[model samples]
Target: MKEAEGEVPLSGGRITPDVVRVGNTVRRPVTAASEFVTELLGHLERQGFTGAPRHLGLDDSGRDIFSYLPGRVTPRFQTWSHDQVLAAGVLLRSFHEATRGSHLAEGHPVVCHNDPGPNNVVFRDDRPTALIDFDMAAPGHPLEDLGYMAWTWCASSKPQAPPARAQAAQVRILADAYGLNASDRAALIDAMLDRQARNADWWRQHLHAPDPRVASNDQILSRIAWSLREHDHTAAHRSVFEAALR
Candidate 1:
């Protein structure tokens, strides 16, 4: 994977592979979405959004080059402290606000990170400080990212996840930190459910594809089951989430 000296192979990419670090830069294989993503990054740079990596053009191999953001990414679905959750909400709001009314919105609401799970977030000093991995960035409602964040950062159904009540409290913290309005808060749970269902459907559609985004058929199956569980779990706790938002 390393084609040159001092190139350190990086891991934890859910889609793109062969990512490597050379000095203060990261090199990743450019995908079909590279042009749009680079332009979006450039826009963020012009808008002074510092949470995302700065697109630094391309490498000699035609790979996308990005400024290396230094921090630790939390393992997926790991429970976060209230502070971490709040910090994540703040960061996401800033990201969405930065793109609001911009040309990248393309007549939509704003550009969504699409996948803003903990695994894509970079933590510094034990706080969620930055976001990485923009392969799925696209124009969408801000709630799209908020819904995905609710599931991955707070409402996970994993064994280590908090109980229903505590999880609801965590969601409230996020909503408050984001300054979400009453109408949006009421719609949050439904948004989260929609995201989980879509996630499951996406995996099912790609189950047999030769896409590197998926590791194996078994892996796809597991993700499908996990997404269903998340859906059911969120549904079961709907009342609690509603009450907390009230």
Candidate 2:
């Protein structure tokens, strides 16, 4: 493996990036989740999804060196964009299509990369490029991914407390770009809100990390949940969610 960038201290787990160079090609993330990641990589490869990084075998340091894909990494902190939203919609559709019918082992359900938020997305030419981070990416549901992504991007960090009407127009454009039909359009909105509510409670119970990043995520998640519950999500996002269906 190549040089170690030490551990990227995040909330869920420390992503220790170890760069490796095989011939002219360079890759990173060796042995971080060694066996699990190695196996996951194989599965993604077999499924014909080449967008994700390849999981290389263990290195001298016993770390797994994953392939390093090239693209612009979207920031976690940013306002929604029409193009970005469209790109996100398309990328998610692709990811979902790629993961169809892939079942995990008895004990190990195929965990999708749960967080494909802006930070998790890699962009090239103002479009989504690839996915990163898989800490809590386990035994996921495709619709759940849709909900999670919509909550973050469409609702602007919260489903109940989405952006104002003008901005929300752009948000609705995201789902439209993904081709949500009439029934799906209505259902997906509520599904996303429900997922946000559920995720907040889940994270509150599970996230007890010492890292500041984790702490911040917990705080934001708490706020998002609180805002949604305080206003009653159905009432709050009904218009915004419905506008897109129009």
Candidate 3:
């Protein structure tokens, strides 16, 4: 269980710090959910889902070890190409289908990623190939992850962000790629809006005392502000989004 020599510090994302690359494997600090995540990864492996990393057990330091996925992670909140948007939807659906009907689903449709933003996605050849980070994974409605994706991958409050109509179109493309049923399609917008509001509210309490898990206070502020704007943006262009879905 000894950690290999020449450990390289891997930096990205805020919550999980002290991650190091030991050869071709990643060593991350074990969290309360580490056991569940490990089992989840194992399940994905058994199901032949290569979109996730393999759980390689713990290091000598008790850090969770996983086979390092090879690909560049997309920067968060950046504009996504139409193909990328479509690929994301397809990837998400595949992931959900992999977990559907599993005991881990806990009687729900599937275990939700809960946070499948661009930053968590690994891309190769300009196409999304994998998803990383499962600390927030839990059993829930599939729309929960899709809704979060809608906000994180499409909506933005930045000056150079896409227009509301364009964002709406991208959302429609994502839904189409996922091949949502009529009922799910009708509920997509509301789910996205609800996720936005919850995200903003979740950050509001952290304004005064930011969690050590987050990257920075300013980053938190940025997220809260972005979520609020995204909510408003989606709401303002609800008609456009609905039309595109049709």
Candidate 4:
């Protein structure tokens, strides 16, 4: 089997996936569902969605290869300005829009970047340029994807909460950028809460043993709970989240 030249370990993400950089490509373990991911990426490429990496064919080691996007993933726990938050929303909406009417969305909806948080986003010139890590991508509701972004980007899970006014304003900005409808605005809070709760449950199930991965999962679970609580607080204050959007 041919080996990847000058392979260097890539940081972030759990250890099991074992992603590595080789030249201008990233190689990672292939799973049973990898072919599905490849097909999805091909569809995205054909549709001219530049927000995701182009999937290359498998390597000699049987790892899936993808064109390495030339940008950094936004660091965890980092706060974004109102503009940056708005940009994130726009980028996410673009992805959703691109997937609409594509083959991936014909029968069911397109595969969503189930985790589109800052950690999975690539930023260039301080703006989110693309999304990476399609490991969790699967057919799902667009709101489910947006809900994950709302919880993560809004800092609802952070230890130091932003002022209520600022938080509300940013939330409004994001919703406006995405052009969410009345129904989407009405469902946003519940969807966000549901996403976080589901994440906590997944972490709890997967992070049973002790390791760095376990610690990371614990932190994620804590944040998920925190975000859920914060969303509930917002709901208590406002009659409807749509008021913020309007």
Count of clashing residue pairs in every prediction? 0, 9, 0, 0
Question: What are the lDDT scores of the predictions, listed in order?
Answer: 0.89, 0.60, 0.86, 0.75
Model 1, residue 7: displacement in angstroms?
1.6
Q: Which residue pairs in candidate 2 collide?
A: 2-19, 2-20, 30-63, 30-64, 30-65, 31-63, 31-64, 111-138, 111-139
lDDT of 1 by residue, 92-184 (tens): 999998999999999888999999999999899989888889989999988889999988888978777779999999999999998899899
Error of 2 at 43 (Å): 2.8
**lDDT score for residue 49 of model 2:** 74
Residue 175 error for model 3, in Å? 0.6
What TM-scores do the predictions have? Answer: 0.96, 0.70, 0.93, 0.85
Name model 2 segments beyond 4 Å from true. Answer: 1-36, 105-112, 157-163, 206-235
Q: Write the per-residue lDDT of candidate 3 for residues 123-230, one digit (tens) a residue.
A: 999888899989989999989998998878776666688777888888888998998989998999999999999989887777767446454678889878878987
N/CA/C clash count, model 4: 0
Candidate 2 lDDT score relative to the true structure = 0.60
Give model 2 RMSD, 1 decimal.
5.4
Off by over 4 Å in 4: 1-5, 157-159, 207-242
Answer with 1 or 4, whichever has the higher TM-score: 1
Q: What is the lDDT of residue 222 in candidate 2?
A: 66
Q: Per-residue alpha-carbon lDDT of model 4 for 61-165, expressed as tens digits?
A: 888999998877755746688888888999888888777766776565656888888888888888988888877777777789877787678735344777556
Give the better candidate number (1 or 2) by lDDT: 1
What global local distance difference test value does model 4 have? Answer: 0.75
